[model samples]
Target: MKYSFVIPCYRSEKTLGKVIDEIQAKMSEMNHQDYEIILINDCSPDNTWGTIRNLCSKNENIIGINHAKNFGQHAALMAGFHFVSGDIVICLDDDGQTPANEVDKLLAKVIDEDYDVAYAEYAHKQHSGFRNWGSHVNKVMTEVMLGKPKELYISSYFAAKRYIVDEMLNYKGAYPYVIGLVLRTTRNICNVEVNHRERTEGASGYNFKKLLGLWMNGFTSFSILPLRIASYGGSAIAFIGFIYALYVIIRKIVAPTEYLGWSSTMAVLLILGGLILLVLGLIGEYVGRIFISINNSPQYVIKNIINYDSVENKN
Candidate 1:
């Protein structure tokens, strides 16, 4: 079967060549001559695009795509999915942390077991503390919001069948969450344990703001649990306010001369006002995404492409 490797690169100029070389070596060992490598540069400020162009020039099987601006990793993956012509599409990081030599494990599961997708599960991840925490947050969010199975671990490195990729492309919304898209598509997914390596180069691309935005994307795009929680919270708060009003009336009737402190009134007002604003902001986020989708926003804009003579880009 033909294999397609889709890697979303950012600030990976130093290590991307090695990753590609490892993939080539692995394919050769497996006797997989029919394969393609798709490298997407997500507007990295470094010489990543230059490196991709160089690789494309050296190997006709390599395809290079340059984004106009930074669109995050998930957007880059969606962009790459459009040009996949292989039976099995593999997605992995640009960095060397995801071991390319162990890709056979993931591919074996998909090919032997007939699974729709197989995610690479690491025994001990080599990410920094902050990145690990971000990954933890993402794991919890997927389980709670996207109905992901608790036993199945999701990572950036995974192998998916062509049908699964095709079903994922049906999502035309502006915000695309890869985990949510996969979970919604099929439950016939498994995990393969693989060794994670330490980063020999730059740091991670995700910061606090980007991680928070990713969480919001997962929350708003795939589920309505947050909105339901907001509704329930409002009802509970209203009930408490009504009960407090009755208490105040009882106290007033029992002791007319007692002083009702302004502090308590202000405290209640502040709490209710804060909650109202929070719920409004949450609603605003959902509406804003809907508006952007209705306006037909492109997920990612491609500035240039190399070795795409036969394939037409649909983005």
Candidate 2:
């Protein structure tokens, strides 16, 4: 069967070529020929695009796509998915940490088990404590949002049947978390244990702040839990205020000599003020998503596109 591999490259110049070489070797080992590799450049400042161009010149099966701006990895993946023409599509990071050879195993699971998607689960994660914590938060949020199995491993490395890819592409949202999209699309998902290696070079693109932002994005985009929580909180606060007012009325009626206390008034004011802010923040989050969607913002811009005969030949 024909296969397409979509490798999303950011500042991956350090190991992109190595990953490609391993994929080629794996394909050769499996005696597979009807495959193409699509390298998407997410406007890396490094020589990642240059390396991809050099590889494309040497290999007919390799195609290159350059973006006008740096969209995140998922946006680049979406762009690559749009151009793929294969029975199956596999997405792998260009960082070389994920073993390209193990792709065959994922493919086997998809084919043999008749699964829509097969993903790699690292036998042991080689990331720091903070990263691991962030991953766990992401997983929990995904489970709460999409209602998928909590154990489904969401990795950049996965092989999907053509229909799954098509279904994913049909999702047109600004905040497109690929793992969530896949889970929403199909339930025939399986995983294979694979090795995860340390990064060959360069620090990760996501720092603590960026990771927190991603977490918020995933939470807000997939679920309305935050909004619901805010609603419940406001209602609870209002009920407490009503009870307090009733207490004050009873106290005033029972003890005509007693005066209203300043401390109690201040406490009530502070609680109400805090609740108002919390509710506003929740509304802001939902409004922000709607504003972003209505603007028709492109997830990733294409500064340039390479290897498409139609565009290249036209010029």
Candidate 3:
């Protein structure tokens, strides 16, 4: 089968060449040549593009796509997908953390198991504590939203059949979460345990702030639990206020002196005020997504294309 590997490169000059070499070595061992590696430079402010160009110059099968700007990982993946014309398309990070050797296992599951997509499941993660926690949160949210088997943890290292890639790319939204998109498109998914390694070169691009942003984006784009919780909370608060008003009325009528306390009044007012703001914020989150979508903003802008086929295709 023809395979197209899409690697999103961002300041990966140190490890990109080694990863490519590993992939090529493995492909040679398997006697597979109908393959191409698409390296997308996400406007890295480093020598990443130059290194990729040098590699491509020696190997025609290595295609280099330099984005006009840094479009983030998902956008870079989308851009790479457009150039892939293979039976299967696999996406992996430029970082060497995810071993290239395990890719064959994922491909086996996809081809032999008759699964549309086979994603790598890391048996052991090498991330920090907070990163692990964030991953767990994302997993729970995905399970609740997609109603899939919770065991299937979506890994960035996955092999997808060409049709699945096509369907995922068909989605025209600014906020593109690849796992979410895959779950929405197919249920014929499986996973294979893969070896995870520690990053040997640069620091991770995703920090605490980016992690929080991703969490918020996933919550707003995929689930309505937050909004529903806000609605329920507001209703419960309103009910409590009505009960308190009733108690005040009954006390005033039964014994007028029983209502001579400002503490309860102040407490009730504070609770109500907090609840109002919380509800408004929840609504605002949804509204904010809609506002961004309606503006027809490009998900990512390309400033230059190193070996891109067409200049007009630059967006």
Candidate 4:
């Protein structure tokens, strides 16, 4: 069976070459020389594209994709997914944290046991505490918003069948959440424990800003549960207002000399006003994303492509 390794690269000039070497070595050991490695240079400030071009020139099996701009990690992955021709597709991080040799573990679940998707479950991650905290929140958000299995952990490294990749590509949205796409497709998923290594190059590209953007994409793009929550919140707030009004009426009747101060009135106005604005903002976000998607914004513009394939990508 042909295997395709899809790597989304950003500022990976230091580690990209070693990552490819490891992948080729492991694939050769498995006697799978028909495999292809597709690396996407995500408009990094570094000379990542130059390195990708050099690698592609040396090995015809290595395909190089250069994006017109940095469209984030999921978008870059989608760009690579569009051109992959493997019967089974595997995704990896540009960093060397995920050992290429452990890819066999994910492949085993697919080859030995028939599974549609396999995710790499780290025994213990080597990320910073803050990064781990962000990931934890992201994991919970996936479980709550997308109804993904609580036991299933989604990470950068995973393997999927060609059919799954095809289904995911059908999504034509500005924001693409990989796990959200997978959960929409199938429930036949497995998890494999793998070794996680420390970073040997530059710092992680996933910082505070990117993580916040990813969280917003996860909430706003794939799920309507946030709208539902807003509706429920509105209802609860209305009920509280009614109860407060009843209490005020009772106080006026029981203690005729008592006067309800402007403090309570101002407090109520602020609370309701804030809730109304919050709900409106959420609706506006959804509508804005829909308009952008309808406009047919290119997910990732291709600056250039270097590959030995028969097809040409000049757009």
Candidate 5:
């Protein structure tokens, strides 16, 4: 069974070559003869494509894909997924945070244990405090939005079978969340402990805004739970307003205030106004995403591809 790696690269010119070398050394050590490495450059500003071209020239098994623009990591992975022909496909980061040496741990589950997907569980994650917090929030959101298992850690580092990969590629939404796609596709998932190395090069591209965008993708793209939440919240707010209105009416009948109760009236108006606007915004998010999809905004586009077509992996 040949193993194919679909690695997403963005501004990783400095470290990508080293990562490929590590994979070559490790896979060779494992005596894995039939394998291919497909690298997708996510339109990095740095010379990532040039480095990928160099690597492809040096290694016959390497397949390089260049995106027209940066379409986020998951989209880049999808581009690579379109061309893999291996029995098992492993997804990893361009940086060495998740080492290629840990590939064996994930591969063992699929090859020996007969697991459909093997997610890498880090004993001690090497992310910064802020990034770790973002990840924690991301995990919780996936649990709530995508109905992911509470204990199932959905890290980008995972190994999946070709069938599952095909199932995942069926998704054509404008906002693609790879882990969410996998969870929606299958229930046979497993997690394994692996070593996590701290990034020794450029910082992660995820900012506050990007993290928020990812959260939106997980919530708005694959699930309608947010719309349901808005409905529930609006209903609760209306119920409270009804009770408040009854109280004010009773108060006016019992003893009409000399002051027309302007303060309390304004307070109720403000509260109800804010809640209505919030609900509308939530509704608008869903509608806007639908409109975008209807207009056919592409998830990603390939500007130039090299060393991918002729290289075939015979299963």
Candidate 6:
């Protein structure tokens, strides 16, 4: 079966070549000569695009995609999905830590066991403390927001059947969250254990701001749980306010001279006012995304592409 490998590259000029070499070596070892590698440069502030061009020049199976701007990793993956022509599609990090040599383990779940998608579960991740913390938050977010199974761990290194990729391609939102799309698409997914390696070149591209943006995308794009939570919270607060008002009325009637404290009243007003603003902001976020999507904002604009035909990208 033909395999398509899609890698979203950022500042990986130092490690891209080695990652490709390992993939080639593994494919050779497996006797899977009918494979293609697609590298997407997410407008990295490095020579990543140049590296992609060089790789494409040496091998016809390697394709290079240059983004017009830095649209995060999920958008880059969405861009790569447009050009895939394989029975199975595998996605992994451009950094060398994803263990390309052990991809067959993920492939086995899809090829041999007939699963739609298989994720790589690292037994012991080699990321920094900050990245690990972000991953943990992401895991919990997915479980709560996307209805992802608690046992199924999601990572960058994974293999998906062509049909699953096609299903994911059908999403047209400006903010494309890959994990949310996959979870909503099907439930027949599993994870395979793989070894994680430490970074040899640059650090992770994700910082606090980017992580917050990713989490917002997860919350706003595929789920309305955030809105629901706001609604429930408003209801609960209203009930409490009603009970407190009744108690105040009964107490004032019992003793007409009793002073309803102004400080307590101001505190309640400030807290309720803040909550109102928070709920309004959440609603505004959903509306803002809808407006952007309605305007047909492109997910990722392709600046240049090598070894690919002139086909329209469904951004």
TM-score of each: 0.98, 0.92, 0.91, 0.97, 0.97, 0.97
lDDT of 4: 0.91
- In the range 56-94, model 6's lDDT, one tens digit per residue, is 999888889999999999999999999998899999999
Model 3 per-residue lDDT tens digits across residues 22-100 = 9999899888988888999989999999999998888777788888777678878888887787899989989888888
Number of colliding residue pairs in each model: 0, 3, 4, 0, 0, 0
lDDT of 1 at 184: 92
Show model 1 residue runs off by greater than 4 Å.
310-315
Local distance difference test scores for all models:
0.94, 0.85, 0.82, 0.91, 0.89, 0.94
lDDT of 5 at 63: 90
Deviation of model 6 at 120, angstroms: 0.2
Clashes (candidate 4): 0
- Put down candidate 1 lDDT per residue, 1-315, tens digits, no spaces: 889999999999999999999999999999898889999999999999999999999987888999999999999999999988889999999998999999999999999999999999999999999999999999999998888989999999999999999999999988899999999999999999999999999999999999998999899999999999999999999999999999999999999999999999999999999999999999999999999999999999999999876333411
lDDT of 5 by residue, 86-169 (tens): 999999999989888879999999889999999999999999998999999999999899999999988889999999999988
The window of 10 residues in a row where model 1 has the poorest summed lDDT is 306-315
- For every candidate in turn, the CA RMSD to the true structure comes to 2.0, 2.7, 3.1, 2.2, 1.4, 2.5
Question: Per-residue error at 9 for model 4, in Å?
Answer: 0.5
Against the true structure, candidate 1 reaches a TM-score of: 0.98
Query: Which regions of candidate 2 fall more than 4 Å away from where they truly are?
Result: 256-261, 310-315
2 or 6, greater by lDDT:
6
Better of 1 and 5 by TM-score: 1
**Which model, 1 or 4, shows the larger lDDT?**
1
Measured by TM-score, how close is model 3 to the native structure? 0.91
On TM-score, who's better, 1 or 6? 1
Question: Among these predicted structures, which one has the highest TM-score?
Answer: 1
